[model samples]
Target: MTRIGVITFPGTLDDVDAARAVRLAGAEPASLWHKDADIHGVDAVVVPGGFSYGDYLRCGAIARFAPVMDEVIAAAGRGMPVLGICNGFQILTEAHLLPGALIRNDHQKFICREQRLRVESTTTAWTNLFDEGEEIVVPLKNGEGNFIASPDELDRLEGEGLVVFRYLDNPNGSARDIAGVRNQRGNVVGLMPHPEHAVEPGFGPDSPAGARQGVDGLRLFQSAISALVGA
Candidate 1:
């Protein structure tokens, strides 16, 4: 089975959810602790969301330096796939795996709700299962979810087709409605939304069919598994 590593920092709250998502996507989930330097031979990595390190200093400032991140960084540099969600996105930016930064929402308050996002680019490992320009619903809960980048960097990302997911409703005032982005190589992706939370149909965000029928986020893990297994 394709094994995906799910990292757990001191305050991580979504490792279990991420692991379940991997399992649902027909992959094995390996636990990677924050203080550990090993990656446990997992084929891919997921940095789950939560208030890592109690969100001190900054959203991901402290968690980005955890020992396991060192291995993750190296793996990502070698073209291994990596996905970061919510606070994980913050960590990715802090680790310099992705350009730009996440700041407090423009409203300066925590927001928690179902979010709609467009599949801006299907070229990345984490988004290849989705059709380009299709919309998806997922859960988004965060205080610092606003994504910002310099105009030059933003233009570069847009030009290079690195923007993976964009918000349909423009919540939190993220720059250009960017909800997710990928590395130039397309192996690493970071997003402010929680895809894992939406993997289960009956318990995820609401879909047009009815309440809690959204499983659109499951495609993310499935995409990675497909890439790894050559499916």
Candidate 2:
């Protein structure tokens, strides 16, 4: 089975959910500590959501220097797949793994809701299972979810097809409503939504039929497993 690593930093709250999602996708979840230098040979890595390092200094500024991140950076440079969600996305930007930065929400408040997103690209390791233009629902909760980038960078991302997911309603004032993006190599991805929270059927977002049905996020984990199998 493909072994997926979920990193746990101080103040991280979603590593367990990310591991569970990996398990549900038929992969083995490897728990990795922030202070550890080794990644334990996992095929891919997930930087789960939470206020890492108590969101001190900045949202992800402190956590960017965590010991495990060094290994993650090296692994990612070697073409290992890395998925960053929410604060994880902030860490990715702080680590220079992906472009752009996350800032405080324009509303200046923590927001939580089931969000609608349109898949803009499926070439990334984390999004390969999704179809282009497919709409999905996932949970989004964060205080610093606003995505910002320079005009040239935005144009570059668009031209290179690196924008992976786009918010339908522009909840967090992200540039071009971008909710997710991937690195140029397509092995690293960062997004503000919490896909792990939406992977389970009964416990996820509710559907129009009053049933709790938001398993759309499961495909992301499955996609990583598929990519590993193909590799």
Candidate 3:
């Protein structure tokens, strides 16, 4: 089975959900501790969301130096797929694995709601299962979800089609409505939404049929599994 590692930091709250999402996607989920330097040979890595280190010192600022992140950074450089969700996305940017930074919301308040996002690109490993221009709804919860970047960097991201997912409603004042972005090699992806929370049917976002029937986020985990299998 394809094994995916989910790293748990000191204050991580979504590691279990991430692991469950991996299992639902037909991959074995391995628990990786923040203090560890190895990934246990997993095919891919997922940096799940949560208030790592209690969100002290600017969200992910401190978690970037975790021992597990060292291995994650190296493995991602070697072409191993890595996905960072919400606070995890912050850490990726702080670690320079992905571009841009996530700052506090414009309203300076925590926001939690079902968010609509458009899949801008399917070239990344975590998005291959999605169709280009597809609209997906998932749960989004964060205080520091605002994504910001320089004009030049934003232009480069747009020019290279590196913007993976874009918010349809512009919830957090992210640059160009970017909800997610992938690195140049397309192996690393970071986004400010909680896809894992919407992976299971009957418990995710509301579907067209009714409430809590959406499984749109499941494709992300499945996409990674498929990518690893193809690799």
Query: Model 2: how far is 92 from its true place, Å?
Result: 0.5
RMSD of 1: 1.5
Q: Candidate 3: lDDT of 92? A: 96
RMSD of each: 1.5, 1.6, 1.5
lDDT of 1 by residue, 1-231 (tens): 899999999899999999999999899999999999789888999999999999999999999999999999999999899999999999999999999999999999999998988899898889888889887899999999999999999999899999999999988999999999999999999999999988876778766446437788899999999888773
| Per-prediction TM-score to the true structure, in the order listed | 0.97, 0.97, 0.97
What's the residue-level lDDT of 146 in candidate 1? Answer: 96
Candidate 1 weakest ten by summed lDDT: 205-214
Candidates' lDDT values, in order? 0.92, 0.93, 0.92
Pick out the ten consecutive residues of candidate 3 with the lowest summed lDDT: 206-215
Stretches of candidate 3 exceeding 4 Å from the true structure: 207-212
Q: Report the C-alpha displacement of residue 58, candidate 3, in angstroms.
A: 0.9
Give one digit per residue, the lDDT tens place, for model 3 in 1-231. Answer: 999999999899999999999999899999999999799999999999999999898989999999989999999999999999998999999999999999988888999999998999999999999889888899999889999999999999999999999999988788899999999999999999899988877788964345437788888999998998998
Q: 15-118, model 2: which lDDT tens digit per residue?
A: 99999999999999999999998999999999999999999999999989999999999999999999999989999999999999999998899899999889
**Pairs clashing in candidate 1?**
none
